[model samples]
Target: MVLVTAPLIGFSGEIIWPIGQILLPVKIGDAEHSTSTWMNFVVVRSPSLYNEIIGRPGVRKIQAVPSTAHRMLKFPVLGGILTLRKQTIAIGSTLIEEGWRALCGLLRRNLDIFALKLEDMTGFSRHIAEHRLNVREGCSLVRQKKRSQAPKRNKAIQEEVEKLVDAGLMKEVHYHS
Candidate 1:
């Protein structure tokens, strides 16, 4: 069975787990009584297909695929815009995984193009690129420091801050109210 895991988000902007399991039904159920025993596995299928199946007593691990349709619908508008602009947006189960992989691949392949576009649009010269790179490097350093729980590299951070200040990207702050 194909298994895909993803972080689940609900209607109220909260994250939840909604695992989907695709399996064949062994025993049949009628309109009035709806319960089944599949391959010695007993399950109580709900009236609404959209509702999650809560495991009953004696049931162990339940295999599931991430619900792609519900997830896509729950994403914020900015995420939708990003997906739409990529030309690899897919809605259904068959294409959803492939679409996301393609989108990531496209972005990975076009990093230089994106950088050039940003530089051109912002009217930043080569000197400005160096400053931007410095700022990015410093940010990475700070992130590494935070992750490692180590003391800050004040000298290197100060140097990068000065570079950014010279490039007009940042200004010195004396105090905050």
Candidate 2:
């Protein structure tokens, strides 16, 4: 009897890890069958592995099943039959490939929310208050406190303030009243 040894690999949290393994003897179009046509497994350690196997000819479905029975079984231990269930399958490369770019873009967009400007307390507070007003109208006390410091402004400072206001980080208020 010829036994094939499968390598053990780890799936890191949220990070796409790629792996190279033998292509399972499953065809991509065989997912419609009722029997276990999509039972084969591919060990992955990176995102490229997903790209490699998903484009192959004979590959049917690439799914991620939880590595342990402890995840699925909820009965008094032996009550549930020991069986493997397919959790989710990798569909295409759009989400996997461009995922990092999406995350970085989100971080850059919200960078002002996390930044603190001690020198420009009034402007910083106005920015924070305006953002809070736009997002949560009930939070007014914090914003009022932030706008208490009335400091002198210059052209460069005014430009920076206008930039934040234009970017939706601060509210534009006219001093007509």
- Which number leads on TM-score? 1
Question: For model 2, how does the per-residue alpha-carbon lDDT over 148-176 read when each residue is reduced to its tens digit?
Answer: 33355466457767765665444655432
* Top-scoring candidate (lDDT): 2
TM-score for each predicted model, relative to the true structure? 0.21, 0.16
Candidate 2, residue 33: the lDDT equals: 24
Show how many residue pairs clash in every candidate, following the order shown.
2, 8
RMSD, each candidate, Å?
Answer: 21.3, 22.5
| Overall local distance difference test of candidate 1 | 0.34
> What overall lDDT goes with each candidate model?
0.34, 0.35
- Model 1 lDDT per residue over 68-168, tens place: 33221111222121111111111223335556677568658754333322223333323311211214322433233433323465765576567556655
